[model samples]
Structure formats: structure tokens, C-alpha cells
Target: MVQLLNSYISLVIERVTMTDEQLVKECVSGSQSAQKKFYDLFAKKMMGVCLRYTNNYEEAQDVLQDGFIKVFNKLPDFESKGSLEGWVRRIMVNTALDAYRKAKKYQKDVDVDSVGFMLDSKDFIVESINADDLLKIIRAIPEGYRVVFNMFAIEGYSHKEIAEQLGVTESTSKSQYSRAKKMLRKILIEKNFVEESERGH
Candidate 1:
């Protein structure tokens, strides 16, 4: 009985795998049904990516739609070198950066020399805060700083890559990241999420 159940599960998995590949092939061939299936599969995750790059809900939705359009248009180039989802994610990231550049919203120049020192160990107190609250504070940061911070800290982009993508200098990226950290620390401190330590009077 156990063997029969295991065989049944394995067959179900195999059928699902075949269906996914068929869907992709049909989508590449421009089948509307497959396209709908692809959208249903990825829209939620893609929307989360869009939200991270945008300030407001409307802007996020616009970016999401734009990203999906790009994905569909570029589906022919997707040769399965990597996971289709990762390719889609890269497209979304690039689209968000492009939107940022076109809007002239991010800082063009950064004063590297003016970068401040890192906060002290005692000052890094937001570690105790909940993840949701921390995300709220991050979202409150200015668009330029927030994008840089998300790319570098959360999304793991290097300074050089960020600078190249945003059309700024590496030092500028570093400075923005530093400024973001300092601002986050201040915000968290003000919110009493981090306790103040006593120093010598």
C-alpha cells in the first residue's frame, strides 16, 4: 500500500513538471492561455519587486505592468540559461532603475568626503525590532536613499554595480548607503525601538 502511494505521488510530480514546461513553450509561442498562466504564476512575486522600487501604490502598479510587458516581449530571448523567474526578476529590476533615471529623482552627485562614520555598536540597537516595523522604517527613507539601501543591503548589489546602474560614482553609492544607515538608526532611535545607552556624564 505504501509503495503504491509513493508511486502515485511521483507520477503527480512528473505530470506537474511536464505541464510547467509545456506552459512555457506555449507562452513563448504567444499563446494567450499560456500567457495568462504565466502571469498568474508570477504576478504576485513580481509585484513585490515593483513595490520595493516604487514609492506609491499607483507607481508600483505601473512598474509592474511595464515589467510584465517587457517580460512578454523578451520571452523569445529566454533560452533557459537560468531559472525563468530569475530572468524576469532581473528585467523588473532593470525596469525600475530605468524609471528612476527617467524621472531624475535620484541624487546625481554625492559628497564622499562628507560621509560620516559608522554608528557605534551600542547605537546599532534596532536589531531587536520586528521585521515588519523595520521594513516600515526603511520605506520611510527618501526614494534615492531607499533604493540604494535596498539594492546594496537587501538585494546584495555591490557599490560599483549600483553606481553603474544609477549613473553615479562608487563613492556616491557608498555615501548614500552610509547616509541611509545613519538615517535608519536615527529613525529607530526616535521611535524608541532602540534603547539609549548611558555614557559618561
Candidate 2:
């Protein structure tokens, strides 16, 4: 009877859907249950964002936890100027970038222009690949390439904006993005996702 009563209460709690504003208010009001619910709400999606920026699941998990901490701490300041999810996503991305910068792996700069990459988006039909496959390919690339690619291609940030964020020149951002595309196409071809002829040579 005790176990059944606990399950019933859990179900009732799960069924109680609060608006973002309501949840934020509760969280700000120092409610542990509300805070847990808020974390549960955005954790998965934010984890995906963190994963795109990190090398592996473990690193991503760290970023996710850090990001959520920031989110909850800053929740009182969130003025509902945008969707809560969008706000959370921005925090996750920034947190991932912070982790990247702290790791100092981005110190090695590759002269991507020397590789003579064709700077065109018409090269690969990325839509042919599923999200999981694409994510795997993204993660397989070098960290610098991965960061530039995620910022420029996936996140819709312009090269100039990406350069500002990553503390590199615009040319470097462009070169890295081009190199990322070339690497992605090469990987796709190697994986048989695209035909040899369609390798965008």
C-alpha cells in the first residue's frame, strides 16, 4: 500500500504541466521540486547541444550539468524575452564554448587555405544522412573544425560572428568552415553515404 501510494503521487506530479513562467517562478521561489522539474524538462535537448560541442558523452554530461546550474541560477533574470527552450539552448552553447576554451585544444591553428578546399555548400547533400550519422561525422572531425562547423553551419552563425565568438579572424573562420565541409564530404563518401562520383570533386 505504501509503494502504490508513492507511485500514485509520482504520477500526479508528472501530470502537472506548468507553463514556463509558472515553472520559472516556482524555481525562483526556492522550490526543489520545481527546480528538478525544470532540469528534467530541458536536460535532453540541452544534452544534445552539449554533445555537439564536446568530444564524447562524458564531456557532454559535464557541460550539461554546468549549463543547467547556470540556467537555474540565472532563471530569475530571464525576462521571457524569448522561448525558454531557446534561452536554455543559448546557455548550453555558451557553456560548451566555455569548456572548449578552457581546454585550450584550439591553440593549434591549421592553415585550411593550404588544403585548397572548395568553399561551396553545393558539395554535399547532407540531407541524405540521418541526424545520428551526421552527428557521428561531426564528432569525428578535429575539434577546431567541429567548433567552426557547429557555429557556422548548424547554429546559423555567420563566419564573422563565429570569429568573434571563437576569437579568430573571419578568414580563419571561413577557412575552418570550408575545411569542415570538405572533411564531412570525405567522411560521407568513405561511409558509403554518398557515391564516389557524387563526392563533389
Count of clashes in candidate 2: 0
Screening candidate 1 with a backbone cut-off below 3 angstroms (N, C-alpha, C), the clashing residue pairs are: none
Residue by residue across 27-113, what tens digits does model 2's lDDT show? 999999899889888898888888889989999999999999899889999998789999998889889999999998574366554
Question: Which runs of model 2 end up more than 4 angstroms from their true locations?
Answer: 1-17, 105-108, 111-128
lDDT of 1 by residue, 1-201 (tens): 999999999997864675545667889888887799799889988877778788777988999899999998888877776788888888898898888788875774444334333444455444777755766787887779888987887677999999988878899898888787767666766787654342211
Model 1: weakest 10-residue lDDT segment is 112-121
lDDT over C-alpha atoms for residue 8 of model 2: 97
Top model number, TM-score: 2
lDDT of each: 0.77, 0.82
Which regions of candidate 1 are displaced past 4 Å? Answer: 1-15, 18-22, 108-134, 196-201
